[model samples]
Structure formats: C-alpha cells, structure tokens
Target: MNTGVVTGGWSYVWAAYSLTAGALFLYGVSLFVRVRRIVQ
Candidate 1:
C-alpha cells in the first residue's frame, strides 16, 4: 500500500525560500549602498 508520496514538507520548503529571498534582498541593499558611495 505504498505509493511513494511525500507529505508534510511545506515548512522546510518555506524556510529555504525565505532564506534565499532574504539573502538576495540583503545583497541588493549592499549593492545599492556601494553604488551610492561610488557616485558620491
């Protein structure tokens, strides 16, 4: 009776997505700051 279905893995998926988004956001902010500094 085993059909090989995964269940209850949403939390891990969300955690990984959140981490990736946060890292990208921080990287964008850092680049913005660097550009501003270079412009000044």
Candidate 2:
C-alpha cells in the first residue's frame, strides 16, 4: 500500500483534533489553578 494513499490527504482533520486537545488541556489547567487559589 502507498503511504500517501494510506493517509488520504486529510491534514486538516489532525489539525482540528490537536486544536481541540490543546484547548481542553488549557481549560483544565486554568480550572485547577483557580481551585487551588480559592483553597488557599
């Protein structure tokens, strides 16, 4: 099987997935920081 054909040229799909993951990670970190500050 050809590697190019295997990927199916869907670059945007991976980018969107990465963007979503980064956003979620940032949000979780922000929430954790806020909770810690409140506890202190």
Candidate 3:
C-alpha cells in the first residue's frame, strides 16, 4: 500500500529556515556596524 505521500521533512524545513534567518541577522548586524562607523 504505497500511497504517494511525503513525510518526515520537518528537519530540512527547519534547517533551511534557520540558515536563512541567521544570514539575514548577520547581514543586518554588519550593516549597522558600517553605518555607525560612517557616522563617527
């Protein structure tokens, strides 16, 4: 009984989301530092 159903993909989904969020956070921090440096 092999129905076409996808399963057990939550780990991959969470990993992708975590990586994307981490990248965005790092980018935001970098931008903030650069702006502060320019303002000084």
Backbone clashes, each candidate? 0, 0, 0
Overall lDDT per candidate, in order of appearance: 0.98, 0.89, 0.97
Q: What is the lDDT of residue 34 in candidate 2?
A: 100
Clashing pairs in 2: none
lDDT score, candidate 1: 0.98
Residue by residue across 1-40, what tens digits does model 2's lDDT show? Answer: 6556454547888899989999999999999999999999
Candidate 1 per-residue lDDT over residues 1-40, each given as its tens digit: 7799888999999999999999999999999999999999
CA deviation > 4 Å runs, candidate 3 = 1-3
lDDT of 3 by residue, 1-40 (tens): 7698888999999999999999999999999999999999
True-vs-predicted CA distance for residue 16, candidate 3, Å = 0.9
> lDDT of model 3 at residue 16?
100
**What are the per-model C-alpha RMSD values against the true structure?**
2.9, 4.2, 3.3
Estimate the TM-score for candidate 3.
Answer: 0.81
Tell me the lDDT of candidate 3: 0.97
